[model samples]
Target: MARNTERRSALADAGIRVLAEQGARGLTHRAVDVAAGTPRGTASNYFPSRDDLISALVGRIGERLTPDPTRLSSHAARTPDRDLFADYLRDVVRRLSTDPHVPLALFELRLEAARRPAVAKALGAWRQRAFEDDVAFNDESDLPGGRTEIALFHYAIDGLMLDNLTAPIDSGLSVDAAIDELVDRILR
Candidate 1:
């Protein structure tokens, strides 16, 4: 069991390193094994299937990169400060933008999953779970086309993150302005 854990950890680290250098499309079990200083056969011993390896790599990447929504929820509950929620989201976006490797890998996985129903299902579940609690606070209860408004809100925030990734130095685009516009238009 200890050996299995060690190998898994090593493989994950190797995966991250290779992903950093070569991006997700370049990821291969043999490449990870070499980066991990393990025998060529070791990766297959640990991950007999491509899906298993990709799943593990994806999980590891999420562990290292994504913000924990539970933490955000707990913090917001404890503080009762709306600004804190905004700050939390801002920090999460900043991390996503500045961390080029993880964001790029996640983008790659998302694109790959587009044609794979199972992968898309898993990714969708992850996204829903991550954002559902915060999204509940969005107050789209009575507006006309509320569902479409909610979807557009999500789309705008995602677009902001993409913009941030490209222009990491200047995100003067006010999140406050975006949120206010959303509230005025969608929540009225």
Candidate 2:
């Protein structure tokens, strides 16, 4: 099958939607083709196997979740302090929450990873790469947090997103306030 970047990306996006709506079990080449409104076997042509399709989904998720460089530059232009860090956190929350399906799809992938070692390997690599990239960005921007602190924040973010996206422990919780407090208390 000839490679089509645009169609491949569309299929990947459709795969994400299927995963988000129907979960990992529902993720299939046919499902992706259906979601993308492409002909049957289109997704299979793009991703020959389930693993290949999953790998494509993982890469696409990273691309979709990447923080905007222009926005990051704006944040970096400000003082590299706790408040600034909180602002970055706010941006993260905004990004994840704005597109609820993306995070939901990510959660589905993470769940599938626990059962399938192949999925785990692919997902783990993507996560590790993202973590390293975030750490590098922090180091470059002279952020207050180091590796350990960033790791802590990463853990906190996962929990926060899971809770907020699924069923929040507190329905009336203010995410911004939580982020502010997290920055104030977590970052030194």
Clashes of 1: 0
- Put down candidate 2 lDDT per residue, 122-162, tens digits, no spaces: 99999999889889888988889888888888888989999
Alpha-carbon shift of residue 123 in model 2 (angstroms): 0.6
- Candidate 2 steric clashes: 0
Worst 10 residues of 2 by lDDT: 164-173
The 0-to-1 C-alpha lDDT of every candidate, in the order given, reads 0.63, 0.90
How displaced is residue 51 in candidate 2, in Å? Answer: 0.3
lDDT of 1 by residue, 76-178 (tens): 4554334443455455566666656666666666776887776577667766665563455443222133345556655766766656555654545476665
Worst 10 residues of 1 by lDDT: 138-147
lDDT of 1: 0.63
